[model samples]
Target: MLQIRKILLRGAGLEDALVQFYSGANVLAGESDTGKSFLLECINFILGAEKLTLVDEAKPYTHLAVEFVNSNDETITLVRPTSGGKVAAYHVPIADISGSGQSIAPTRKGKSKGPDVTSVLLPFAGIKEARLRRNVEGETQRFTIRTIESLFLVDEVAVIDQQSPVTGKATFGDTAQKRALSYILTGVDDESVAAGEKNEIVKARLKAKLELVNEMLQPLNERFASPGELTVLTDDTELDTLIGSLTGELENLATTRDAIQERSQEATRNILKADSQLLGIRELLSRYRLLDERYTSDLDRLDFISEGSFYFDALQEVPCPVCDQIMAPGHSHGPDSTALPIRESAVAEAAKIHAHRTDLAAAIRDLEVRLGSVEGEKHTIDTELKSLNTELSRTLAPRLEFTTERLEQLVNRHTEREATRVERERWQELVKLQNDINSSLAESGTPKQIWAGIPPKELGEFCAEIQAVLSEWKWKGTPHVEFDEKTFDITVDGKPRQSHGKGVRAVLYAALVIGLLRYAAKNHRPHPGLIVIDSPLTSYKKKKNQTVKGENGQIDAGVEAAFWKSLAKTSKDIQVIVIENKEPPTEMAAEVHYQWFAGEEAKADERAGFIPTKSAPAN
Candidate 1:
């Protein structure tokens, strides 16, 4: 429960401005354009905000002091450079300022060394070092005090239009937003709930393997009549049954393949033999044809000789040489006695040549018939081999090959399934360990509902309190305000806050912030124990001679009076500072602490604005 006790802004050239607050409600009311909003800016700057802003008059200020009380009732003064530099903290009072103290540099969270604003203030607020998930799947980051600041401070613009009180102008993502709320409501962080050994690395590896297993199972499922049957096949016995069936099918296929291979080999050998024999017969036929041609030529010559011999025998006489006398039968010019023997031998030689020509013609005809028979036998063998090869390709070979491939696929799937089984067992072991850790947490005095965070029942009760606050303020048209779970915005009379005008939106936003404070204080939730609101009642102002209407219709005349009266009663336990343009009602003025800034037109000694003039400063 860290609560601001006091804040001071001092400068060398400008007058010292001071504001002191109590545990209850404090109102600072004044005219337009006064430095009322500037106080909120200074408070945030002293905290760990990255940017700082100041009004024109307060620009001369170079240092700010924030004194806050921790849960142990110890006051720590945080002194920081107003122009944005390193911050120094003191356990002593801000009044006893020294030249040095513990230095805590200003930097973005998660980028600094040991001692910073969060490390200093978180112990004061009774929160342990913790982390919040940035997203469902993203990494977790350490929680900073800046996350808790939204509940403690509400600036002018935020008091008018923003929806969730936990949300800041800068995005902290949705999971972080919820985690921050849960941390404040219940003193639990992501580290407390997250199982230790079941780290992200293990979970990620398991997830990848599970995805691979599921992908492989999809195709296997399609092979079955009902794909859903695969769900029951995780056991080893079930897998082995399928494996055995596939093996039997593959064995049958192997037998048929072996037979076809043997027949193809035998046919191939016969084709080679026929080809070799045909080559030898072609060589013999070529030599025989050449020999028969020579024989036929010899026979033709012999026939001509035989015909010449017959003519020679017919011409038995010869003519005289000089006196034109007829020659005797043996007319010889020389060697007259050898003529008769030569003529007789010529007749016998012609007869023998004719017989030899007849025998050569018969042998040529027999050789032609033998060559034709050998060519026909080669053609028959070639056709038989072609038929055998076509049968093997078209039927038996394809059937055998398909069965073998299918059997291989089934065997590989079984091996993969066994590997998947091991991974699944490891994953289950991790899950069991995680569950045991959670159970131990519950047994060790953590609330059963803490693991799941603040339940809907608690949220509904909180919303009921907000509804009661709105009703007490006399809101228009039976205003049924409830927290929407999805968008984390308020639904006014069953309509979202965004559907309302700015004035109405302002009033609803104020209720939500105040309601959180009231609920946290009453329920003993982990809160900063302080809420500072600026311009909470925008609808009550008299703008351009017309009062701004909110909610159902024009705001009732007594709404402002009721609003402050409710705060006065409800804010008694916590410190709440409200800044607005309109003053509090006359009847309820004494019930609340009030300040009025009359602007620069007043006498020099009187309180004209937040910054004092030359006269004096208020205590």
Candidate 2:
């Protein structure tokens, strides 16, 4: 563990100032614009961070030194020119860094040499300038200081990020972040595993392959677990059962479909027969009307014949117009006159005609009765045909369509079963590979659990510690907070830390940083064992026109105080440095070392700032 003892700022033009820090909680409390954040920047510069923004007052300072004890309990002093250039290291005491030192330029990556800070500092933490295998393809990357710097310093931007403390920013890739975290948790660099025996190297290779496979499988598993997707996974037996059920359903639907088709055909045939029959009936009715008209005419003719027969009987004599002489009364020989038939013969002919008329009327009534019967039958058939058409349109169509859709669903289910089968096989192969590696390690008498990348149990424990700390801080959420593996962040009541306001984001960020430190120390994991945070409690200060009100936006007084109190308690095992504008709470005053910078006041010691203010005229 790397623990800072003192940070000193000195230059030819400016007065020398040294700030000493304890292993426990340290508070740099003061008003804004007083160079409190400048100390973090100085620490970063001393630790080989790229560039330093030179504030106007800091421009006068030319050199800065950070004295810290390495993991080996050896005190080392890191000295760098404040103008931001190469670093100089000294093996001597912190008080003697000004005397003799070896100068070394910081390497961006790879093996450090001479006075490079990584070369001297990493050695104490049991790391050499190591080449880490970045991918399963055997590509390598050299460890650098930038990879591990976040483990110690949580800058102003990082303090309010509401994400993982180890996450890389715009310039740093996530792979580097992962490497940094792995280094801290395992304490095993590429150098440690590179020197393994042949069999051990083979086992390591197998383990690496297994890890890669797992990494590939993680998202796939999440996809399987995603919402609005099928939940059941089918094995061969289950698939067979499902297929059997689907087949049975399809067969039944097919039978019903066939029945419907047959019924429709039957109805169509019946409708055609009915239409043909109706047409025949209409033709028969038309013929019946014609016959009725003929019968009526015959009846009228017969009645006229019967009436004329009586008139003929009245003409008993005939006259000859040519001679103007009447012939015998019983005999008529002229064309205009006829002799009357005997009275009996006339009566017989009239009776015959009257009988024919009665017969014709009866025939007309019989034709009318037949026409009425045919029309009634046609009406009944038309009603039946209409009903059959309605059934086809309203009932059978939708049923058939629904059945077709169900068939499609079954086909999709079968496809999914095949895909599930493939996924399962791959998963099983990966499991076997892991088991073989574990067995090999056991046979070789090597500890299987030794420094294997952060296990779920450890992450769970870390999450529990965070929850505990938040509880102590009186955080406004359920006690069921957990770590989000995908995002490498924390969630409160199932909401991500980013969903919170800026103030809560800062608080959660502090909790995560401090919680990880405590977790590392408790587990005896490799870590720098120091957390330097800037403005973690900024939300607690009331600002002008403060309107935002949410977990991350607003400040809770009790929770804020509790945050410091929890830090005070955890500081016993890990060193924590907090930079805040607000004064330390009375409850935590005894536990934390307070350095108050009151740049607004006139006094020198109590009211001056991190950088010395201009001297006033003696009055």
Candidate 3:
């Protein structure tokens, strides 16, 4: 088992950033963008990555050093340049690296006239002179440390990607990944497999077929970035159901919008009706007012006639001379002309006009009341129309728009599934062609199987180890884990690991790595004995006002705690380094090597982050 002890990064005129690890379990928890990922990259670089990923915070740093103890308990420290170059291995610790150390090339192909890092580290992990078959022709290549790195060093992206935890991202590397795992589990290498020779014609035909298959598979592989996509293409029931559900929701939203629109239209119509009646009432009131004025004028004229006749009748006869006489007091002014009778008739006419005026005034008052009531009704209708319009625009319309968008997404997914189905068929054809090539090669010569599958008893034991790991972590389901040889991945409860959500995938991937370590330790199998995981608990952390649920439809309240406790109880023979953003449970603080990057300037014993913001105090 290779246990990491300490890592240091320093440059001239800059503060040295240092992190130390312990034997059992180590955790580096911090905020994001604070060089936690950079630290992982630095480790990979030291292990044998051709290039170190450059980050802005690490720009000033030029050298990195990692100290670890191999399975033999021999302390070894390796120092390499961050700018890329050969690595210097010191049989002693990092503090003594300046004395005497072996200079090893960073890569296997480097012309540095020194041993490569792979050759040096392989023996340290109890693996020496291992080889893996590169192709179906049984041609072998040296299995370097990089071949097994993914199993133990899981980064953030790899932890949640839908690819097999063993198979990694590259489709072409699937065979290599499987062979690497087999080598670890079974203590076997592919060097004993014999390479086959083919005649020129056979080789030419095989080459053509291989090229054709690769040409067809390239686009399919690129289109389906992950195996999960191909899995999705196999069944359309879930997608179809989702599409149906979205369609139903969209229809329901449309119905609601239509209903609101209908109500709005009705309110508008009622408003218009009330407005028309109000207008009619107003016009009628105007005409009635005019008639009332005419009645008043008639009454005034009648009054004047009545008063003038009364005064004339009251006049006494003065002179009887010719026409000047006052008609001799009711004598021959006209036929029986008495001013009293005229006055009485005029007064009666005035009273009739007055009564008509009173009736007209009452009618005007009634019309005014009706006009007010109609106006009130119009106002009420207008208010209702405004409210309906608001609801249609603000509530129903937005909801309808959202549902339409969701339905469109489902439709697009359905279309993508169709395209994937075609690609899947093409992939099948490619597989058949490859199998035919393999058959032709087999018929030509007897080639030893490069990698016989893992023994069933061993595989069963490995699966049980994984189940135990998950059980210890308080995994949501009754985990029945099986290593799927067909997919080169694990299945939990008969479901492929990729089928679960990303959080579950991450947790399951973590379990696989840890379980492998535990299994190797228990069975005395060869393993690196060191595991570094990043962000394994990110999706398990509860955010503000949110309750996180796992795959079993239960709140994951205890999963994170269980994860920490399990790691804390990991065997002392193995070293587990977990990089996370959330804090661990307080109870397990004493059990694990807790390295906290406070993500701020240090106060007292706290750290700022993986990248120091200031120089360390002189001792």
Candidate 4:
């Protein structure tokens, strides 16, 4: 397995920024504009990309070096100048990569007579010298490391693209990509295929093909009113800016609407609570009124009794009717009879009733006061709710509607812009095709070739591997994945891969790369055994205009967790590097090598980015 061990960027006055990798999984995640993408680009450059994309931050770096372990477990370090030159290979670690070492030409046509980078690296992947047919006339080109680089290194732009994961935006490279995949899967190449017929017959055929390609290009060229319009369509920056602005406006409107709705809900709850309290108070008041009526009746009866007792007391001691004997007032007539109370007892009972009635009156008054307060509170709540509803319906809702409509219009415009881009790419492809045909006609002889396609069984197994990867990632429906040889791409549940949204496309593309690695390992095929992917989980990040959905039409909440878990369990034979803006699931922290480009140096230990904030002299 080929594993990247470390990378170092050195300059005369800048610190040597260092990044390390392991055999299983390595993740570099953090804020944007922190050199994640630039790091990937640097890796590509060291792996023989023709040009190194330089940013302002990288201006001070003069040389790039990569240290990796080849399949044979031999450590190799390659150092190349940022300004472009031959790559120096050291059969040692980066610390010892300086001074004289074997010099390898960066390209096949380099001025140096030394071996090229492709020839040196191909053997590291266990692949022998190979050639692929580049045209119908059997014109072949040497299979180089660049041919298979796309399978291992997927950048941000290609990850979310609608194009085939194995292919690039340039249609001219499609055939080479297909043939390279076939070579990897079937261990077959077009080296032994028969050459085409030569002389007049070949020339005539080439002429006809050239004519056909020009015929296809005419309409595409005329699709735009002017060449300048087509040129503008080539760049996506303007359209992206417009879409981003519109999405921001829509998000603001939605946020405002949500705030209003939440306030309105709170107000409604308050009103309901006040209404409940008001009802309780009214019930209490009714009971208090009944108690007050009883108090009044008791007081009147007590007063009547008191007056009658006084008259009785004044009548002096009269004999009991049954005994017919003189008896003292307030005394009993017999053993079973009790003494009757005079006016004093009646007055005491009236006093007790009056006290209770006074307390009851106070309680009733308190309840009435509370009832009025609750009613007022309810009224206030009702008024506030009405205002909130009006604001939502009149102000925020209408604004939201307008913003949504504008967003839709911008999205439609973006779609149109993308279509124009595709047409322009198609036109470029046709022109290249025409050139290829003309070149074929100009050649003295041309060869016809018949290259074998990937065996069906192998293709099926490859697809199954992809399905298993997706299943492990908790993909919705565990959709059936099939390799479509016609399009040289995979299909999910009979649907073309490109038919899905960008988020799905990004994930599916990652699955493709990982599946290739697993399949190669299982089947004992040739592979680089290292995959470097950028922004595979970008769709899952909470970004504007990004919506990650599953086949069931709902957002798959488990996908991110499952993705991290699955990668954490990757075999030791492969090395996977992922650069993202979001952190991995916390549970997998111990399983993978993780780094954070915090984007700011808040702490002494925290890394600011790939480019150090301070400069140091190169050793």
Structural similarity to truth (TM-score) of each candidate: 0.55, 0.55, 0.57, 0.57
Between the candidate structures 1 and 3, which one is better when assessed by TM-score?
3
For model 2, the stretches where C-alpha displacement exceeds 4 angstroms are 71-73, 108-115, 126-138, 162-164, 170-172, 188-454, 540-552, 571-573, 602-605, 615-619
How does residue 342 of candidate 3 score in lDDT?
Answer: 77
- Please estimate how well model 3 matches the true structure, expressed as its whole-model Cα lDDT: 0.79
For model 4, the stretches where C-alpha displacement exceeds 4 angstroms are 110-114, 199-451, 540-555, 614-619
lDDT, each prediction: 0.67, 0.68, 0.79, 0.79
Per-residue C-alpha lDDT of model 2 across residues 155-185, encoded as one tens digit per residue: 6666665456666453335655665566555
Could you tally the backbone clashes for each prediction?
0, 3, 0, 4
What lDDT, from 0 to 1, does candidate 4 have? Answer: 0.79
Query: lDDT tens digits, residues 1-619, model 1?
Result: 6677778888987767787776677888877666777778878888877777666666677888888886577888888877788789898777877878899965454555668887787677765677886654445777776766666788766655445666655364756776777665555667644432334454454455445645554554454325454354586776677678767877776776677578667766766776676676567667656766765676566556545544543653556554445555454442244444555565566566556646645655665665566557656756765765676677767876886787678778877877666555544444444454445444633312213435556777777877988889887657677677666667878988767766667677777777877777788776777888887675444433743333433345666778888878855567778888788887666777877776755565556766666422221
Of 2 and 4, the candidate ranking higher by TM-score = 4
What is the Å distance of residue 462 in model 4 from its true position?
Answer: 0.7
Best-to-worst order by lDDT is: 3, 4, 2, 1
lDDT of 3 at 370: 92
Q: Residues 1-619, candidate 4: write the lDDT tens digits.
A: 5789998899997779898998888999877767888888888999888789776777778999999897688888889998888898888999876677888987777334458787787676577888787666566777777888889999887777666777666576477778788777876787875556656666676677777888887887687547676658356788789789878888888888888889999998898899888888888898889989988998888888766654554555667777777766545663223314646687788889889988898898889888888888888889899999999888888888888888788788878878877787778767766776666555564523223467667888889999999999998886699888776778988888777776778888899999998998787777788899998887543344753334322225698789999999998888999999878878796789999887754367877788876422110
User: How high is the lDDT of residue 495 in model 1?
Assistant: 84
How far is 509's C-alpha from truth in model 3 (Å)? Answer: 0.4
Worst 10 residues of 2 by lDDT: 334-343
Cα deviation in Å at residue 479, candidate 3?
A: 1.4
Q: After superposition, how far is residue 354 of candidate 3 from its true place, in Å?
A: 99
Local lDDT at 130 for model 3: 79
